[model samples]
Target: MERVVSIDRVNNLVKKSDFISRDLSWLKFNHRVLDQARHLDRNIFERLKFMAITASNLDEFFMIRIGSLYNYIDYGKERIDYSGLRELPFRKKLLTEAQDFVRAQNEYFIKRLRPLFAENQFKIAKISDLDEDQKEKVKNYFRKTIFPMLTPMVYDSYHTFPILMNKLLIFGVVTVSQTDKKDQKKLSFIQVPQNLPRFYEIEHNGEILFVPIEEIIREHIAKLFRNIEIQSVNLFRIIRNGDFTLEESDDIEANFLEELKRKLKTRKTGRVVRIEVEETCDRWMLRILKNRWEIDEDNVFRAPEGGMIDLTGLWSIVNHTEFKDRMPDRHPQVPPLSYSEQGETDIYEVLDDRDILLHHPYNSIEPLLELLDRAADDPDVLSIKLTIYRLAKESRVTNALLRAAENGKHISVLFEVKARFDEENNMREARRLQKAGCFVIYGISSFKTHTKLMLIVRQVEEKVTRYVHMSSGNYNEDTARLYTDLGLLTTNEQVCNDVSEFFNAITGHSIPTIYRNLITAPRDMRQQLIELIRKEADNARQGKASGIVIKINSLEDRETIAELYAASQAGVKIKLIIRGICCLRPNRPGLSENIEVGSIVGDFLEHSRIYYFHNDNDPILYSGSADVMVRSFDRRIESLFLVQNSLLKQQVINILRYNLRDNVNAYIMNEDGSYTIKESTGEPPFNIHKEFYEVTLDDIQDAKLF
Candidate 1:
């Protein structure tokens, strides 16, 4: 018999169940990333890459999350968050945590990686540590190259503080005016040149020494202001508010593109949310900056120990050619369709046999690219339609679409113009598609179409066939090499018909009330998920076999969490593999004792979303682009498809099994919402990425012989 909770106990669990703040949970995720930098088991260069990634990740977090919180405080809109933290107190606590995180990151980089780099024949040398010959060379290089690009502006009666662009490093010079006999200090600033490389290499006795451009500029900053006595030159950067919400305007369809462009241009001038300065900066100088920016002490981030304010630039050092051996070898991708001596296998023919599941950074994304290439050239293919959220700078997919249009094939492309950070690139690509005589839709108003779908309508023989490719990641080829994602290719008529209706619903005014195979958001995806979870709970209550497993980037939906809690209380075993924010607190007694949660962070980001439900013996699986966040549930156009093919279902099952078994790269979440890294005692360490890479290689090799 299944254990059941009394009505009173259930009510108490509901009232007491609290969520972790999304912002704080995100920091915990980043900390796991920083833990990679602290781990001695990983390669030195790879560890450096982890530190650099964390730096880049934090930059965006401040610009969006922290910036939004400050806006709330500014407009007297202080309210309690999901975690029951008021806006003011949350900001204070979050700032302290951010400071501690930054301190820990700096300590790890300085104490742990500094000696490792020296032993590996690579060094980040300070200007003071350089020999006289190297110093002279750096001085000359700065005077000739960097000095010409700098423009120093003084802050006084005539000029106000220059509005420094977001995330740009600049020197805040505290100087004594030479014109005044008394020692009077004035403030001046100069932005570091963006075009110059962040790391400058000096070859001494065949040993490579990496030097930061900022140090070179700092040593020569005094020369820029010859008339002033340079008292102190502190390096600093600012993160501005980047939370831009598009308001509904009349005639939005006509001027939406222009308005979006305007917003992008003005985003740089948003309110200053945070300021980062060197720890050695004078107290008075830091105070003046704080007062001018109107930010409190919580917004001030002092990098007392980190070598650089922005470690993202350290990618130049981490990716140097000399240290390639220290980094993990790039696994050779498995081409799904291998050319045989008899003939090249048609990709469509392969899909017709069975649905192919792709695990990225392990299995190559080339097969899907080739599928599009083949569709574009085939005379039988009538039209190509796809929704693009983000794309690489040089996107082969878009280029192929252009070629199809040029070849007299109809092409329809939906470009999401508000995909944060990639808006400009999306706009450029949309315009390029329009120029090629292809039909283009900007996006649905009040919603962003984030589904990864591509449908090709091909007329094979007397019947019309629809080919579909759906994935959990973007179509960007570059990110496919970095992010772990899943994609599916199938010629199933039911799925293709639903995809057809999906495009119509987004591009036109058609409201799809039913789908043959796919579950779509902003329509019924959330309800479908709730119903599925309820079904599992019902099974558990009936004393039938039941279990739930999900792998997603985030889980923040309250309704979903409550349903999972109910299921857990009914004796349903629940497992979650979330890569990022997970507000759901698991393993709470009488609340979620049957639930377990873990996250994996390593070389390849766990970006795929897979949901599995054990329906009495037969299991059902789904893969899609949607996370469990509220934004994805109600405001974004997303899709999740049912995986019914037995072989494909088992492949996804194995994927989850490996991630669950991972002891080295996985972190388990505690009931308090903190994560502890998984450790192997006596048991052999199993890394999911490594295991998947080797298995896929073997599968590809086996296919080659056939």
Candidate 2:
């Protein structure tokens, strides 16, 4: 075990911290995700999803974060993190810490959560525990269903080891041939068919019994090895490196697709990162398997409670009818916001009346959906342009764009094919759009088009008018139903022009050199944000009620963090609601004494990025994709639109105020970067999300009645 340092020492080290690496901070955020699994208030299926999410997140972490770290280590490059602290060379130390993290996760899964699952009637039974009738059913099922798909391999001097597919679960068994005079031994293996269900349900005496598929395979091993006596059986799983590398050749487009296919194949043979073995495995069998795989002892994990190596199977258990009712239904709340009374009300006109903010899941995404739907159908609309990062599987937004294209409206869609894990989805959608007569842009070769904006040009009579919809989330209606985000529909000419130019630049039409009222990244967002913070500091020094409120997914940008620290020193009262990866340390004496940071994690994901600066005479508000991260500001394509209308600014401020006042679900972040749930007081505890939902629903209904 690595030496454990005192909390004070860690704080002292952080005091001089120049850059807190975003990767490490991100890992801490994943810990928070894991924390949700431990939360009692969350439903069982929700908890299961959280666990699956964490596992899925870690897999990506290994592919991206750890993969990047390994690249840096290989090249002997030393880079500092967002905190400006020098990162130590990645060697044994980092690997050791990673191993420790995995071990802790395993322990938490087994000791804390799995037992609770078992107690809740989600039983995982073994074959030995089966009765005569149950055993008979299992035998019949295996013979009829599993036997046909079985491909068993035996290892000897003549036979080589079979190729184990990545993330595949299999069993290694030692068998002795009864026909051999010397009782010759052979090493054999059988895969738990990926196509087969992880758990098999048997109905016995009107009670449901679930047994792992591996148990049935174990019981039927004798059939596969007809003339052998099974000496020992051990279950194991393997994780291989799955990082995809894109080539920079002249035929980049063709190369990319080819590389993607190659990656899919290479994923099975890449270096092993992790291996898991059942606890009951014999020492000799374990050694032989490890030696064959060339896996080190540190890479091996022993399953607890003789449990199955992978509990992702718990997803199947979650599907059982008994637990299904307990899961929250998040769809009904996202019904159409506008009624028949608001008939054909122009989205831009509605926003012009007041800055309308929509809370997803609780309220509805229909207003935003309606905006695009109307744009597509409106005959007067000449052109529609937008940037798509990751649309939903069945994207209404994409369908709207297709409709616009088919209506002879010139449509441009900037599809970012590099949106991690959604690469294939985006690529498929891009091809579909192209086929549907839409001019599709595959995004800039270097930077991802992460900004979410829609531009509509309409020719009404003798005049050309521009309408824009700017948002802090994707146009993905499905996620819009679950992710809390903000969208603004406006006829502001300056913002519209900037957004149009942005789409044009991304699609290789024309490079936009300057944005009039918007802050765009890889260009001016960082400097503009710093200048905004400085303005706040100046206002504070002049004795005005200077304050700043920001709600973002992350706050790991060093310059932004330092500027915030400076603003805090200048008496600017700063409140930050960061949902994830916060590097800024708040409430420290002489450093960030005036700054307070908190996070809200609930049923819906808080995905919007909103910024409010008290400008003394006139406050300024903006919302966009930028998250105060260096990469967001300097590497990726991002946009922040200045909220010009007073009513809209007030609405934005109100949302921030509500979030800050939330006590029921808010987790306050301390100066040391740790978080604690807000303790309830005597006053009615504010569930900001729920309240926002009710307020929006009431407002929409009232507007309809009026």
Candidate 3:
């Protein structure tokens, strides 16, 4: 473990303290996503999808970031963060900021969506506001579907607060004892079962009416507590600290899978971070609940007027097949540019000729899946190797590997079992692969192998030839359709050989001392990035067309930020397209005057990492999984490879240009640490996603690239 240091040490190292707080920057990013929900041009259902995404994003933020802050405060670790605040003050600031964010989200939901829903003849009706027929339907649903599932848990001197599941909605019920009216009111809560649908939809004479289960409970919850006088019934939810550590024990030390299962249980009992109550919650009731939870005012949140506590339940509406016409048209994935060359569908043949660059969601991932599926059954293929960071629940990639292993081919798969939230799934897949006779390595201890890499060793005419696939995202096919990422399919000997060595370095004891065409983290990725940036600066000083363009998910590493500042100081124009947390203070005179940062949060997530350096007309482009974060550089195992193929290089360059030029869905980061939406004056509305879908690969191929 690295030593815990103060912000003084960080400032001394960087020679400046102009970085933004990581947590606050993340909140700003979420707000940017919220802006997408507010976009008038997007379809209503698509806007609702954006809203649901922001809700889910905020939930995770509270569970991880807020949870970690509490831990820091509890442990007396008063280390100042980048924003020059200690743990306690930071926690207070974040809590207040989060409260405001949730308020805006709820206001938007109520003000915009309610009218939109009503106008569209789809209404989320309250129980009291419903007509006689609708009321009867809700009453029937409460009896038939909801009544049998509810169990009201009581709390008193002998009883304790129930182990509330994380992010699950629960109702706080206040009741007066029948025997003594003056006695303290009994406090109880009924948990809403996640298995049941959160809303019940009914068709009324061509119009659809959707009603929340909570509203139904408000009318019918008295039945759960038979004899007690129900004084108040208010809806509430709590987010808990989901962060957990794996400790070594006798049984756990031997069995990591069992340990993971054990640790998952502890996550439920984690400390409560935030308690969300309805705005109409009684003052006395709120006070009593806060006392019981041992939380202060900062941790309590009141729902916005007429807004539900969790917006994730809106997904059912967003994903309804009936609403398809109201949502954006789903564009079919296009075939790769390499596919039309001599009309070849075989990835091996295409890769053998030249590298294939894939821009996902716009371009299909079928070619990569096809590569694995073919290698599994190929008689010449001898071995298959892959690194598993995250995979779909039903992964075609995993299925291909299983088939290859079943066919007597040697298979080695490293499942990073420490992947947050995906740990159990990866463990399950790892054990399943192990049972099928494949060599399954859990992970390198204390280091997550986040690199997206795969190597297939095939013997063609008694000569071993390696085929490699590297990506900026995971092997999950489901995410490929939602996240815009770059992938490379190559048979280049040096790149393939280096990737093979990378696999060996992880799965065995052999260290990769030399990498011919790849840059890996915890090795040389950071150093390589610094040198590339400095090279641009050097070129600018020597009177060459020098600039740098970076498109990444985040930028938070202090050393990297310092180097960027230095580069900007030396007159190297830098353009950063960061989709998430960016700590670097750009566009500052004498610090980073030549730098500009823009973020895009659109229909699809901008997940690909593309780093470009204008090395005096002969530009260099590299893309892989590593973000400009401290963990990616110094802790995690990451990979970034050079774009050597001419056509593929232009494809990456074109992607950067498109993102740089997008005005409708892009926001430029301001010097005040906020973002302003990029507006179009008289120019056509430019949406890179829409353009990517409309313009086919053949059209892109025909276009000239300077």
Candidate 4:
């Protein structure tokens, strides 16, 4: 057995102080996202899309973060948050902030977004706002479609309370009995069908009319409760605690597949953490619900005047074709920077000659997919091994792998079934792959395999060569077009060996070892990165040029943040472009004065992870799936491979440069953890999203060397 080393527990107050609450930082990131919706620079439909994105983002936040917090509070387990508040106080503060955010979100939709949408010939109509003809159409549609799907469950003395599904819009109807001598009120619930569209759309007079399904039901709900006096009807939605740790079940550690299935079923009916009720809901009805759910007023959010309970349903309108032509077309992807070839070049041939580094969305993921397609049919190919965290709904990656497996080529796949919100998709895909005779591993026992890696072995004439693909994003082709990510396709001998060994260790019982180029995690990535930072600090103290530049999605790990603080104190300039959940207190006096942190929320999600360290004059670069989060280091399995090729290294540095130069959609982090938009003082608009789309070889040649 490996000896357990006792390290000094004293962090000298670094852990508690100078850090923003993780939850609060995440909410702030959402606020940044919300700002995109408010920004008028984007097209109307794009702005609507951003608004829907924020709504979807908030739904997950409530499910995961809010749900995780109550998992402690509800069970009476004492815990402290990053903000130094104990479980009870933290819960109070967190819920208050969450309620405030919901209020602002609703206010935005009702006040600004509604008017803007109205100006664009779009209207979310109520039954009262609709003409008699439109009302009759809605009534007929409701009776034909939504009426049958709704099952009105009564909650009274004889009946039990039904299990309300999470995140579903429900109509809480309070009715009085038809024949009772004494007046009595009864509560009945009707859940809006998940299958039906959220809105009944009717094109009228060149304007798009979207009537909320709830509104239509409100108009005709009397048909369901015939002869009964409907006193009041409240439209509301509930967000249940959908977060569950694998540790909660012994069955999870034993049979993960079965436990995952069971957990998916239970997630729908988890404890109610939040209730978003229409602002006009009767107080007594609200009180009854709060009392039954055993929750305080803090748990309920009053929806704005808009009848829509869930703003995420706005995606239906965003996807509507009425304004499709008004939106800008997607930018065409240029050929990848390093490979220096067009579409006709063979991927294997290019990779054999030199490594190819791709900056995604700007550069297509086609070459990587093409490589797999060719490898699947290639007579020289022996096997293909890869790790999958999240797969696209319609995945070319999976299809290619399936074809490879069917061609009698050995395929080893490590599918992460522990990916939250993606577990069902991963599970289904993994089972499909397994049925196709592909050797599928359901991740490691306790940890998620978040690394995006693939190794293909082939032999032309008794000489075997390995081609490997590594990336910072998923194998999801759809996301590849929406997310800014970096990927490498190479035949480098050292990286290939390291990836092969990584697969061996993950698939079998052997412990993962240190690699020559790949800095793997739950073991070495954190220490390796810290050592590099300290080395730069050492260089800075010696009066040599020293700097650190990193672009990642989140930076929440305290150890890494402390190292960056230490590096800043040593006079090493640090620049960070974090897209979300940055907990580091940048630009603070005596703490992190030399460090600058900025975030860019643009057309594409800033999903890539890049680490650049100035080694005196030379620079070290790496791109990988790992973020600066503790989970990426100590909990999940991750890998960061060095960009050894000089050209590829420069390309990464250029990416960092472009990200640092981003101002249009960029927000700079302040000492207090709030973000301010990075304003350009009369400088020409230089949007990285636009610049990268049209990047040519001459542009790279003329660019100043980092």
TM-score of every model versus the real structure? 0.94, 0.87, 0.94, 0.95
Q: Write the per-residue lDDT of candidate 1 for residues 135-198, one digit (tens) a residue.
A: 9999999988988999988886667778888889988888887677553778888998788899
> What's the number of clashes in each of the models?
0, 7, 0, 0
Best by TM-score: 4
Candidate 4 per-residue C-alpha lDDT over 600-675 given as tens digits, one digit per residue, 9 for 90 to 100: 9978899999999989878888889999999999889999999998777767777888788877989999887789
- Candidate 3 stretches greater than 4 Å from native: 1-17, 180-183, 246-253, 341-344, 694-706
The lDDT for every candidate, in the order shown, is: 0.84, 0.74, 0.84, 0.85
Question: Arrange candidates by TM-score, highest first: which order?
Answer: 4, 3, 1, 2
For candidate 3, write residues 460-531 as lDDT tens digits: 896888889999989999999999999998889989889988988988888877897788988888898999
For model 2, the superposed segments whose C-alpha errors exceed 4 Å read 1-19, 74-121, 153-163, 174-189, 203-207, 229-231, 244-253, 260-266, 280-298, 306-308, 320-322, 331-355, 696-706
lDDT, model 2, position 488: 74
Writing each residue's lDDT as its tens digit, candidate 2 over 131-204 gives 88889989999999999888888877778878887777888889887677553887888888898988899755
* Candidate 3 clashing pairs, residues 3+ apart or interchain: none
Candidate 3 contains a number of clashing pairs equal to: 0
